[model samples]
Target chain A: MDIFSFVNFFLLPGVVQGSIYALGAIGITLIYAIMRYGHFAHGDLATFGAFTALFVAGLLGLSPYAALPVAVVVAALLAIAIDWLFYAHLRRMPKIITTIASFGVALMLRSVVQIIWGVDTTSYTRGISRPENWFGIRVKPHELVTLLVVIGLVIALHLFLTRNKWGKAMRAMSDNPDLALLSGIDNNKVIAMTWVIAGGLCAASGFFLGLNTELRSLMGWNILLPTFAAAILGGVGRIEGAIVGGLVVGVTEELSVLVIPSEYKMLSSFAILLVVLLLRPTGLFRGKIL
Target chain B: MDWLSFTIYPVYLMIFMCIYGCLAIGLNIQWGYAGLFNAGLAGFFAVGAYTSAILTTSEAAGRLGGFDLPFPFGLAGAMIVSGLIAWPVGKICLRFRSDYLAIVTIGVAEAIRLVAKTEDWLTNSARGITGVPRPLGDLPYAQAQLAYLAIVGLILIVVYLLIERQAHAPWGRMMRAIRDNERAAVAMGKNVPVRRLEAFMLGSALMGLAGGLYVHLARTITPDAIDPMLVTFLVWIMVILGGSGNNRGVLLGAVIVWIIWSASEIVTDQLPAEFALKAKYGRMFLIGLLLQIVLRFRPEGLLPEKLRRAPLSEGALSPTGHGARIQAPHKEI
Candidate 1:
């Protein structure tokens, strides 16, 4: 493909989609690190967030981007409530039980979305968005917004993880919960904060995804494997690694159409995931596996 | 409901219960004995269904599978193909914790679904394969249903006996040992990975058989026939609730869960047109929530595994102590 066509068709769109995946991966990584189990409900939780945004946007007659904050709060609260109600009792149980419960939560969440919003695919805006020519590469307003929001969120998270006390405590917990507890960190607060951050990022991921394409009850469920792949590929616990992994997965998925049929793009992520697990389960950044 | 119709309803339901009973038993071998979580039961199920459908069905224009093979051959092909698919997935993930196995299985299931949807030449795309030959399909309606139920019941009995034998044998003991204490099993010179892989493959094969039976009964196969969460999670709940390690319990669980599931469908289907779709999802929400309640209140299930006395050794009881967690969290992914 020519440079302009490659950029327009693959690179640009890949990065935009990658940003959304990165946001979701960050949540997965956080949950994996702190909770010690995969949250199978995460994708549906994202669907919940996006549809929550859709609801707010419809009521207010505002752009979907304008409803991001309210949606994030709603999703965050829901995450916390889920953790408190369902997971807290199973803290002493086997990790697999919690994971299974998360699967249950996923189903519940998806059903809620389907019931509230119905199953039809809906978009933030009705009109077809015409991409603007920018140095021969096509760009859309929402794409630009997605990029800006991702960059902004990443920078803010970076600062929080480094400079904020709770963020540092979360890092400490991720490293070794027992040691962190011995060192006088409030494990409950750190757990709550982790959910907050993960939930917020999940909302952003779902919103940006809806902004880029369209929102369906299963939009998050479809991309879930890729998000998990990105998290695993980047190393399970590394923030920067998730972003890099997400972009690589995204770009490769888009670029794969050059050689293989476009329909098989989803298969590529699974291949990448298996290859990574075989070669380096620790991920590219040497993060913790669990 | 009339008494005769009600009697037939349960008979019809029994066929499904037997089919899903096979799936639950297969999972019991994997999770209950082996401690390997195979989350993509539906994927293996789909592989079996499609393979059997393609193998036994008469040919049509613009699609594959005109072999018109015998029913037994198609069923065996279903098992083999499903096991073949599980082999690679097991090889990759079995070396790790059950968590990785679970995630990879989900990935495999999703990829399989995508292929079933997009590969027109292979699966006939969304149209699906038709004319799958049933063993007693040529009979009158009630007779066919009764005959099919008999066939499925016989298969379930045979499978149950075979699996129950394995579960009580030295092999089953070794599997439980490996699951309870991997380190001890490894130190005892047990090939942990290989044994786990065998269980995984065996379970997948049974699931495939169930799928084959399902397709044959329906006389059709479609991408939409399988719902990953609905089938897989429901089976998981069945095994867990039925008593994971007990064959009889697994069968009982399958019957109970399937009844609740199908009966709920009947109820939801009766709702007004506008509320029908919402009620459908509402039922899903209830099933999902039911899993949580079961896990929380009754982790041992209705019929807990009958504990058997093991020949004691000092090596078996180590620092981990007795009653080791069912699935120890593996630090290394």
Candidate 2:
């Protein structure tokens, strides 16, 4: 294939896909850092968020982009509510119990989505838009929008984490929960804040994925393994690491079709995950081992 | 319903119950005794099912079968192959915490499912492998089912007795010690990793056995049969609800949960077609909710593990010791 075709078909799509995985991985890494458990419901929660955005867009007769904020807010609240109802009491027990509970929550969320939307694939728009040629490469409008939004979200999150007091509190909690508690950081407030940020980002990721591809009940679940691969690759608790990890996983998956059967594209991410776990359990950014 | 038909359904349910009983007990060994969170139970189960199907089936043009082996050999091959797969997985993942094991195992299971779906030469791809022989399968429907049930029941009983013996043995006590306190077990000179690997492989072998039993009963094998929800999560709930560490408790859990699961389908079928389709997901929602309620209210399950207590010296009863005894095992994962 020509370089232009490679750039358009492989590189651009990989970057876009990577950006989406980065969004999801950020949420996962943050949850792992703060709560210290793998949030199995995360992918399904993203599915719920994407569907929520679709619902809002249809109900309000607005553009999907305009409905994004509503979805983010709703998903954030849903995250907090789930934490309260299902996970709050389990806080004192073993973290594995919470993980198992989250698996149940995953099933619940997916079922709820299926009950509401049925199983057919749906899209925000009816017709496809051709990618505009820029220099020697081609990029679609939505793909550009996805990249820009991801950059904006990451920069804003960086500022929030570095500058804001509550954000510092979250960092403190993640760094050392007992110490943070001793320092008079309201543990519950920091946790709720983490959920808000994680949930909102999860929605944005899901929305972008749905915008680029078609939305289905299984879409989030399908991407979950790759998103996780990205999170662990970047290191479990590192934001910047997650971004780089996402991009790497995404580009590799897109490129792997050249060598392996397209049917086995997902295996690329799984391989990356296993390799990373074997070589560097702490991830690329030296995140916590746990 | 005719008496024969009525009798057959219950027998069929019982047979399935036995299969699930095998799975639950296997999971109990890993999760209850060793505290290893194996989210890829379906992978092992699928491996066993596919191995047995391939071994026993007659010649097929495209796939790797034609062994035409007997039922016993198929079952044995299933267990051996499944255990072999678990070896590397346990070796790598057992060093990590329970959550990491959970995610990694989930990945492995998904990978296995993908392979089963895509590899045509091995699994016959989406069409799946069919025409596998069943023991006494040539008999009339009811008689065949009863015979299969008797065979499975005998197997289940044998498995139960063997595992019960192991559970009461010193091996079981060491496993509990490691689960309850890893450092203590290590300090006491126990080979934690090796012991864990043993439990993992043994449990996986039984899961393979369950898969073999399922394939023989269905007389076919399909990738869809390895559903994460049906094979993996259902068994998880069974083990948890039945009381993880206790073998009999998990069997009870299997019987109860399987009845509810199968019966719920009948109830849902009574609804309008559109509503019936949705009710399937609704039932899943209820099952998920049931888990949360159980975890919240009775994390110890209906039948809690009974710890063996040492006899107290005469007039040497200590209230603090008694209180510690009550609180000790409750901390288990």
Candidate 3:
């Protein structure tokens, strides 16, 4: 294949896919850092958010992008409600219990989605758009939008974490929960805030994924391993690391077709996860071991 | 339904209950005794199911088979292969926190599913392997089922007795010590990693045996049979609800959960066609909700682990130390 075709088929799609994985990984890493438990329901929550946006777009007769913020807000609220309903009581128990509980929540969320949406693959728009050629490179409009949105969200998150007081409190809590509480950080509030950010980002990721590819109930679940792979690869808890990890995993998955069967693309991420967990559980950015 | 047919339904249910009993007991060994979270029960179950299917099947053109082995050999092959796979997986993942093990096992299960789906030469791809022989399978339908049930029941009883023996043995006590307090276990000169691996492999072997029993009963195996929801999570709820750390409790749990699960399917099938599909998902939602309720209200389960001695007041049944936080030096962003 020519370089242009390779870039079009492999590099461009990889970057767009990476952006989506990055968005989801950020949510996972944040929740891992703050809650100290892997949220198994995260992928399903993203599915819920994506479907919620689809619902809002259809209801309001607006473009999918116009309905994105509504989905984000709704998902954030749902995240908080779920924590209160299913996870809050388990906080005093082992974190593993909370993790198991999250798996239950995952099943519930997926079933809810299946019940509402009827388990059909769907897209935001009816017709596909052709990629515009720019200096020997081809880029689709939605793909460009996805990258822009991811960049904007990351920049906004970076500013918020570095400048905002609540953000600092979240960092403190993640760094040392007991010390953060000793320093008068309201633990519950910080946790709630963490959910808001994670949930919103999760929605954005799901929305973009739906926009780019068709949405199915299993879409979120299928991508879950790769997203987790990205989180751990970036060294769990490091925002920049998650982004880089997401890009690496995405690109690797896209490029793997050249060497292995396309049916086995998902294996690349699983392999990365195993290798990373075995060699450097601290991740690329030297995140917490847990 | 006719009286004989009706009687067969309960027998069929009992047979499945025995299969799940094996699965639940296996999980109890890992999660209850060793505190090793293996979320990939379906993978091991699949490994066993396919191995037995291939072993006992008369012949096949595309896939690996034609061993035409007996039922006993198939079951044994299943256990041996499943245990071999678990050895490497346990060696690598047992060092991490239970949650990481959960995710990794989930990955392993998915990977296994992928392999089963795509590897046509090995698993016959999506069409799946068929026509595996069953022991005493040539008898009349009712007689065949009864004989199979007897065989499975005997196996379950034997497994229960053996595991119960192990649970009371010194090996079991060492496992509990490691689970309840890893540091203390290590300080006491126990080989924590090796012991954990032992429990993991043993439990996996049991799951494989259950898979073998299931494949023989069905006379066929399919990639779709290895559902994470049905095979993995259901067994988890069974073990948790029955009471981890107690073999008899998990067996009770298996029976109760399997009855509820199968009975709920029957009830949902009675709904109008339009609602029946939705009710299936709704039932899953309820099962998921049931887990939350159990975890919230009765973490110790229906029959709490009966202590031979006074239990540790703090971190009772907790897998890891409550206050043992790993200190990672903070670096400037």
RMSD of each: 2.3, 2.5, 3.6
Cα error of candidate 1 at position A214, Å: 0.5
**DockQ score of each predicted structure, in the order shown:** 0.63, 0.55, 0.55
Query: What is the C-alpha lDDT profile of model 3 across B198-249, one tens digit per residue?
Result: 9999999999999999999988888897667657889988988888888988
Error of 2 at A45 (Å): 0.3
Candidate 1: tens digits of C-alpha lDDT, residues A109-144: 999999989999998898888999988989998999
Per-residue CA lDDT of model 3 for A81-120, tens digit only, reads 9999999998867778888899999899999999999888
Q: Which sections of candidate 1 miss by over 4 Å?
A: B1-7, B309-333
| lDDT (Cα, tens digit) per residue for candidate 1, span B229-320 | 88998998898788777888888899899999999989888889999879989988998888888877877788877764445866456544
Residue A57 of model 3 has an lDDT of: 96
Model 2, span B249-284: residue lDDT tens = 889999999999999998999999989999999999
Scanning candidate 2 chain A in windows of ten residues, the lowest lDDT window is A90-99
After TM-score superposition, what is the CA distance of residue B277 in candidate 1 from its true location, in Å?
1.7
Q: For residue A13, what is the lDDT in candidate 1?
A: 92
Model 1 accuracy (lDDT, Cα): 0.87
TM per prediction = 0.96, 0.96, 0.96
Q: Tens digit of lDDT per residue, candidate 2, span A1-290?
A: 89999999999999999999999999999999999888988888999999999999999999999999999999999999999999999887777888899989988999999999999999988898888889978999999999999999999999999999998998998898889999999999999999999989998988999999989998888888899889999998899989999999999999999999998898899889888888898899998777
TM-score of 1: 0.96
